[model samples]
Target: MISSLKRFLIGRPLKSTELGEQRLNKKKALAILSSDALSSVAYGPEQILIVLATVGAAAFWYSLPIALGVLILLIALILSYRQIIFAYPHGGGAYMVSKNNLGITPGLISGGSLLVDYILTVAVSVSAGTDAITSAFPALHAHNVMIAVFFVLFITLLNLRGLTESATILAYPVYLFVVALFILIGVGGYTILTGQVSPELHTPMGTTVTGLSLFLLLRAFASGSSALTGVEAISNAIPNFKEPAPNNAAKTLIAMGSLLGILFSGIILLAYFYGIAPSEEVTVVSQIAEGVFGRNYVYYFIQGTTALILILAANTGYSAFPLLAVNLAKDKFIPRMFTIRGDRLGYSNGIIILGFLSILLIIAFKGRTEQLIPLYAVGVFIPFTLSQTGMMVKWFRERPKGWLPKLLINSTGALISFSVTLIFFLTKFNQVWPVLIFIPIMITLFKKIRKHYDEIAEQLRISTCEEATPIQGNIIIIPIAGITRVVENSLNYAKSLSPQQIIAVHISFDKEEQKKLEEKWGQWQTGVRLVSLHSLHRSIIQPLTKFIDSIERRTTGSNYQVTVLIPEFIPKKGWHHILHNQSSFLIRTVLLHRKNVVVATVPYHLKK
Candidate 1:
């Protein structure tokens, strides 16, 4: 029933040979990979406005300059990542770039930061999408947490269904959002230019509370930098593209960057001219839509698409996180389980884990986008800086054709990225310190995990110089509940091993039952020793394990080996197994860890 349900939801499992067919073309790839970056325009400009709004309505005018700073950084990242796509076409993104050019430490730091950013992408994007919904219908504001969590679950299920399938399902909303925003910006710009509506310099909302300073401007820039969060995803996911992967991926990155720049700048300009103010209940995009269309159908259309694209933005994290995890796993810095693909050829484990973590963040922050935005950009930009520096080092070391020019671009990007990271750390330290500490903790964990894998390989290594230990004889012990066909079969199987000695033992809680078992064994004329252990506390496993431990202690380091053969009767139906006591399973689970003991299960299937 479970398998049938799974097949129904995710569809039938595709063959491994079908993996090639699953790779996406540029159009579809843009929607899947660029959604996170594209969706940020819904709230990215508002983040800057939000930070600047603390001083007064007049400070909201600073949002334009701050957005242009973010846009400059975005251009640098796009250029740097395009180089990354060409250089490391196999696609580990920032993790691979930093690890290969720098050292393992930097690599892990980049990887850890990307991991954190991906998780935040899901949380922040969904929370923002929920905010858009509540903005549309004020009555739904109370249930935002539930709405955000449901979106997470829905997106996670779509990803698990398969990559190409998810791209197909999620691509439409992205294009629709882009078109809708273009219309909003076009209409809003026309009104201002044609004098249909006069531009307001002051928002006429909040009073003057504080003064504007350099630190405040830097803080606003740091907040707006969240717009660039998903830009690295394209570089990380080059492998997901069709043949000629690098060129196609680079083109997609350019297209995505172009769209992002246009939309982000357009929104910021409109917000400035229209005198938009950040609202707690309604999003900045919703306000812009209303200003242009005045709560008409087009207004709701923009709101709906904005919410949709934001919700779908989580797909960027969904696509990139697993790919990065796979690279880490291949390097032995993480568990190998992440390297395994699901039935749909997606990294199901990593996808599910991302979903779970994002849901937790949503619940913890009460699905508030403003609360979660502080922790967003730092994780992404740390990798941005590291990746750019890594590439710069590569250019200096390799000195390929035109390496000097490439180095200059990357060096500038690295400088800008480093500055943004520092500003985010200093300005949002209270909210973001946990992530600063988390990256180091993650790096330490990566080292420990790598060390453990190395130790395991060394221990499991077989050397030609080592001598093999020979077994002198085998002493087989049959654990029994009563005189039954299953016990008889287990004894027969044990006898086939040509053991030096055989003993049948039973845990007898009642004296009368013990005597009856002995009498029955005597009547059967079996030459095996029948020792009955009496448990005062009525604990069967304790006495049974004690008996095995005593035997192991008596023959420590000897050539002889002890084998405990557990007899279990298999139930015909899956659910019927729960009806019986699982003593054999419990006994086997405890004894399997003994050094000198070999545990075996002898199953007798029930015809019923």
Candidate 2:
């Protein structure tokens, strides 16, 4: 029944040959991989306002310059990652690039950073999506965390259904969001040109809390860099694209970057013209929609689509985290189960783990986007710097054609990424300090897991020069509680082994039971030795293991093997097994570590 339910939800298992058909085309690929980067425009401009809003209305205009700076850095990163795509089309993303060019430590650093970043991406995206929902209908504000968690679970199930299928389900909403934003931009632009609406009057946002300085502007830029977090996912998942994956992935990246730039810039400009300020309950995009279309259908249409796209944006993290985990698992950094594909050909373990982690963050922050944003950008930038640095080092070593231009592009990206990392540390040290501690701890854990796997392999390796030892004899020992049909089956199975001798050992907690069994055995005349021992403390495993130990110690010089046959009764129903004492299970569990001891189970299935 459980299997049937699972099959119904995730569909029947796909054949390995069907994997090629699961790869996505360019249009669908954009919706699958680029959703996080594109949907970020919903809250990117507002993050800048959050930081600049600290210094009063005068500092608000500075958001435009800071936004342009983030855009320039965005272009540099796109060019840098495109070089990565052409060079390593197999698609390990930053972790693969860093491990190859740099050493294992740097690679693990990149891998760990990315894993944490992907979890945060889901948390931030869904929380922001919840904000859009509540902004339109204020009554839902109290249930934001519950709403965010529902979307995470929903997206996780969709992803587990397979890549192409989820892409088809999600692609329409992304295009709807893009089309909706362009309409907002076009209509808003028209209103300004025709003087239907005048520039919004600016109000001072209370007294200046902090004096405006160069540091403050950089802080705002750092917050705005959240827009660039998911940009490298395209390069990381090159294998997920259709045939001619490199060309298709590169084109998708460019297309995604173009859309992201246009939408992001348009939102920022409109917010500025309309004098939109970041509100706790209402978002900047929500405010802009209200200003342009009022409370009409178009306004609600924009709100609904914005919420849908933002929630689905977590698909980017769902796609990339599992793919990255597969690479790490192959290298023995993480557990091997992450590499296993589910019934629908998705990495089910990684997807489920990502969902749980994102839900934890949503609940912890109470679905507040502002609180989560501080933890968001730093994880991605760490990988961004390392990946670009890895590429820069690769160019100098390989010196491929056009190495100089490639080197310049990656070098600039690396520098800008490193600068962003530094700014995040300097400015938001109070909030982001936990992430600084998390990366190194994760790297250490990766090394420890690798070391454990290496030690296990060495212990299991066979010796090629050693000769095999031959056994001279065998002894079969059966532990019996009473003379029942299960005991008879065990005795017959032991006889079939044709050992030198068979001994039935019983540890009796009561004297009357011990006598009754001996009398029955004598009357049956089984012609096997019956050894009875008294357990003062009624301990079963302790006395039985000791008797086996005495026999092995006595036959130390002889090449004799000892085998224990355990008799078990199989229940008719699944829950019926709980009614029995399970003595066979206890003996088997204790005897597994004994040297040169073989254990076998003789089962008698009950009809009723």
RMSD of every candidate to native, in Å, equals 2.1, 2.5
lDDT of 1 by residue, 1-608 (tens): 88999999888999999999889999999999999999999988998988888887788877766887988998988998999999999999999999999999999999998898899999999988888988999999999999999999999999999999999989999999999999999999998889877645545434343588889889999989988889999999988999999999999999999999999999999888888889888888998899889999999999999999999999999999999999999999999999999999999999999999999999998997566676778888888999999999999999999999899999989999999989998898988888867888999999999999999999999999999888888788888889999999988887778746788989988999999999999999777888899999999889988988888787787988888889999998889988999998889888888777899999999999
lDDT of each: 0.91, 0.89
Candidate that scores best on TM-score: 1
Model 1: pairs clashing at backbone N, Cα or C within 3 Å: none
- Using lDDT as the measure, the top candidate is 1
The local lDDT score (0 to 100) that residue 393 gets in candidate 2 is 96
Which ten-residue region of model 2 has the weakest summed lDDT? Answer: 199-208
Task: Score every model by TM-score.
Answer: 0.96, 0.94
**Which regions of candidate 2 deviate over 4 angstroms?**
200-210
Clashes of each: 0, 0
lDDT tens readout by residue for model 2, 1-608: 78898888888899988999899999999997989998889988988998888877666767777889989999999999998999999999899999999999999989998898899989989988888999999999899999999999999989989999999999999999999999999998788679777645443333344588888888899999988889999988998999899999999999999999999988988887777888888889889999999989999999999998898889999989999999999999999999999888888999999999999988888887567676778888988999999999999999988899999999999999999999999998898898868888999999999999999999888899877788876788899998889999988878876546789999999999999989999998888899888899999988898899998998788878888889899998878989988789989988988877999899999999
